[model samples]
Target: MAVKTIDDTENYTIEWDEEIGAIVFTWDKYVSGATFREGCEALLDAIKRRDAAKVLTDTRGINAHDAEDQQWMQTEWMPRALDVGLEYSAVVHPDSVISEMDVESILEGMEHSGAEPLVTSDMAEAREWTAEK
Candidate 1:
């Protein structure tokens, strides 16, 4: 699989994985507000630019999310992502229980968006699940 870097920042990196035909978001530590929103938008643009439907989000390094950011993600970003043909997502959860719970809460609100989402602690599992047709 060819991995092309789309956007790289201190907080996160978004890439296009050609082999699996998925946009991958690899996060680093805590990110919030504008940084978080920008990263999400960049991921959406990557999906549209590559004409991809699946996404793999590696949140292993992330430790927390702002409440406002989480709300924005579920209410704003998610719908736009789905509108742009994001059909499936695999999230590699962070080790922090609080962060994991936050991720779960965000995912819960997205359940009705018609996208299949898999949450796991293992990167291999996430990759495998995201690549599925």
Candidate 2:
């Protein structure tokens, strides 16, 4: 299995995990504004180039999202991702209650369209869910 690092920054790391066959987003304690958008664009580029169908987001290290970023994720980023063939998604919930709520809201909005992500507290569970797809 070939694991490729697509994007690595102080805020996050996005990579292709060949074992699970998914693009993984490993976030830091806090990410917002331009950095968050850039990371999302990086993922989108990888998805297009690799023809990826799955994504696993590890939010365990992250805190809350800015309202604007959350809105951009639900409105702009997600649709673009789906258009580029992103199918299944799994998100490992953040430890903080505030961040968990933020992530959940985004997932709930996405449920109405596109791939509804599997949100879990356990990374193993999230990995398994994405790998199965």
Candidate 3:
């Protein structure tokens, strides 16, 4: 059977580095009619295939998303993370509104688990944080 390619993407930025085991994502470009959660789930699944548990999402390049997207990420996506033992990380501009909301969404996930996401404007800092014990 054919798999779910929810949408045929064009401008999305997604890459995985096997050497570093990092799933890098840059979602600054918006594509209409594509659900953000589906994109992320595809990414998460892709990274999981190679046991890449660390992620650094760049949200500075795109527009802000709605509450449903945020709730979907925090409530639905995060809980599923337990299955892969993933550690979340992010590199976001300090002034991006979407960045703030994403951090807040991750914080909401903390209520469900002791695990808190590491976020920073510096990519290195976020990567280091995610790498910590």
lDDT of 2: 0.83
Q: Candidate 2 has which clashing residue pairs, if any?
A: none
Q: Which lDDT tens digits does candidate 2 get at residues 43-132? A: 789889889999898888876788899889888888888888888888887666776688887766666665767877888888888888
Residues 63-103, model 3: lDDT tens digits: 45666676777667777765676655554545666667656
Global lDDT scores for all candidate models = 0.83, 0.83, 0.61
The candidate scoring highest on TM-score is 1
Each prediction's RMSD to truth: 1.4, 1.6, 5.9
**Candidate 1 vs 2: which has more TM-score:** 1
List TM-scores for all candidates, in order.
0.92, 0.90, 0.71
- Candidate 3 residue 20 Cα shift, in angstroms, is 4.4
Using alpha carbons, what is the TM-score of model 1? 0.92
Model 2, residue 48: what's the lDDT? Answer: 92
User: What is the overall TM-score of model 3 with all chains considered together?
Assistant: 0.71
